[model samples]
Target: MHSDRRVVLEVKDVSKLYRLGNIGTGTLSHDLNRWWHKVRGKADPYAKVGTINDRTEIGDSRYVWALQDINFKVYEGDVLGVVGRNGAGKSTLLKVLSRITSPTTGTLGYNGRLAALLEVGTGFHPELTGRENIYLNGAIMGMSRKAVSARLDEIVDFSGCAKYIDTPVKRYSSGMIVRLGFSVAAHLDTDILVVDEVLAVGDADFQSKCIGKMNDVSKSGKTVLFVSHNLAMIRQLCNRCIYLENGRLHSEGDTDLILGHYLTKNSDTARTFEHGPIRKVEVIPETESIRLKCHYKVDRIVHIPNLGFVVNNQFGSSVFGNNTLNSGMSANREFPAEGVIEVEIKSPKLVVGKYTVSIWFGDGQEDFFHEPDCVEFELIQKSTSQFAGSAKVGSVLTDCEFKISAL
Candidate 1:
């Protein structure tokens, strides 16, 4: 991967910073001031930045660094997946590479025709019909009219919008618009393609087509930079991936391993709770024969914030669990000390896997649990059977049978 096979893009220490100020002349003044400093051969006063989480006030000038000290290189034919939480700067990074916006600091160097499907039909002409927009978008991406015409039928068919190929894109549904837009970009004879998660389009079949198209693009020696929240898709589409957190590169590695780390590290349940004492509790499992019995000693009045648990597989991710306070029947009962409390979760549709559980008591919204330790459980195969001895057969168990009611 490190070999010098026409390294197209080299982004070194790239940073994009935006300033905050009262609108109008104040913003004008700040921009002029920064420019004036540059003319004097002196360094820009804003060149140095403070910490990421630095505090600011109404009167004090503030800034946000969308991309911070980032560094990565894309070789020809590499498909790189960029993953992060919202506001993690994944989109900002793509914009920088696509040249839609410039970095506040650092540099990006690349050699190739780079086209981005950032937002659906971003460069489309609302006044034009679908047929017209195709040529227009192609030209905008540095493609000649001849190229667009050559791929016209494929684009229209790929979008499954051929019936509406002559219709104005403005009247097209968002999903249709996305399909057409991606179809255009995918066919562009570009060396690199930058895509942000605009694939929530068409249907499941169309989504699979787009993913397969990207797979083909990488196979054809064209580079791709894909950004998406769906880790499953990222694992399948990319061999290498970059994880961004708080506007900086957090991790980069094999797609599966990197996404696995990113998903857990930045997951919603990544916080610890603080709570005290539990009242009445209910234990529920889908398994009809299985039962859970619990005992609690309440010495004083205390609030149990949230009950939390983790579902883990021997190799990787299973599930992360949390109970909404007072969720379901848990809110209706109270537990007194020195008594056995039995709880039943009827027909829990749990997938076959190992599970860990933790019960907590604290403030409102699961601030903390009774103790830091979690309870554990295991679920073995039951109604499970294997097909040719390969594919998974059952997801969850249910005592289900059927007979022909009518012919």
Candidate 2:
């Protein structure tokens, strides 16, 4: 048994293995064959071949390891973020830890109760009403009816779905469904919580509420296991992070450092966008950072191209955008085949989030290059306000003029 003072959860040499082309078609026949062989007291011919625990030797030896010898310990009040690219086995790891699926090998030990929000609507019953499903989900998590009832109002209020408490969950919108399901999971008095990257579905407000709740939960001394593509949120909520890559633990340490390694390891970068013969783009140093500066030039032999920029937030919301033509400004000159254009600004005036810079080079006379999305950046905000207004990382800087008028 682990302890809050020590480690609350420990996974030792844990791994999950699945067979290839080994999916069930006639399981009953296979079972009968095994039973018959056992009754005869003779080893089944396919036994050794079919049931090997070696991940490398399984499934015609073409096996995939969703997790490979993972080891970690989470202490009470520790929030651990598990991040990776798509198909990086992040969800599979959570499934194993949540006991939704059993590991093929290794032992997992935990002292306190665990509640998992693997998918937003995982525990929700479409036929059941919100009020009923709350109790149902609580019971599923090993909570008593009385405990669920005690927290029912809080859950409903938190979900902001009180008016539809008696309505069937099937009638709820996808957003509402996810909200209520997460609320139920959040309210459970568990020693640890595991949430997958599905939080990307909800609106901004709902996401904010989820983050706030997770913060409060962490403060109350519960262990947290979070999986997300939102690097900013992960960095803010988790101090430590584990990076999974191709079914293996790539790195484990501070959130920023781990994510940095994860990104550096798995980044797939393309040069630029291709709209037509008139326009093209090439990223200078596309990695992860808030501030970005680029050079755009047009051919003097052809038409003069107009350049524009759009700065967006992580959620793809266009916070601000401007173009040289609309601003009644020009690039000061035209391009000579491959001339240099310098555009700089102190960027990313939003929370710590992934942002991409959209560049458009067009003739404006007709459509030189059309609006072609180019350049990507990841903005990591400082941990505190002390770092605010200190250093700018993007192009463009503004001097704010403040004046006080009193009557």
Query: Mind giving the per-residue lDDT tens digits that candidate 2 earns over 1-407?
Result: 23536788999988776655767523678668867887997754333443333333334543456677889888888899998877677898999999999886688998888888887578788999999999888887789999988999999999899999999998998788888878888887788988887677787778878988999998998888999887767877898999887677878888878977875654421244343443344333323223334444454444545667776655666766666667554545554565444444434244444556676666666555544345555555445442323324333334468899999
Over 4 Å off, model 1: 21-25, 41-43, 47-61, 268-407
Local distance difference test scores for all models: 0.69, 0.71
Candidate 2: lDDT of 62?
33
What's each prediction's clash count? 20, 10
Q: Give one digit per residue, the lDDT tens place, for model 1 in 188-295.
A: 788898889988655667877888999999899999999987565676678789999878999887876786677456433222323334433333333463343444
Per-residue error (Å), model 1, residue 404: 20
Best by TM-score: 1
Candidate of highest lDDT? 2
Clashing pairs in 2: 291-393, 291-394, 344-395, 344-396, 345-394, 345-395, 345-396, 346-394, 346-395, 347-394
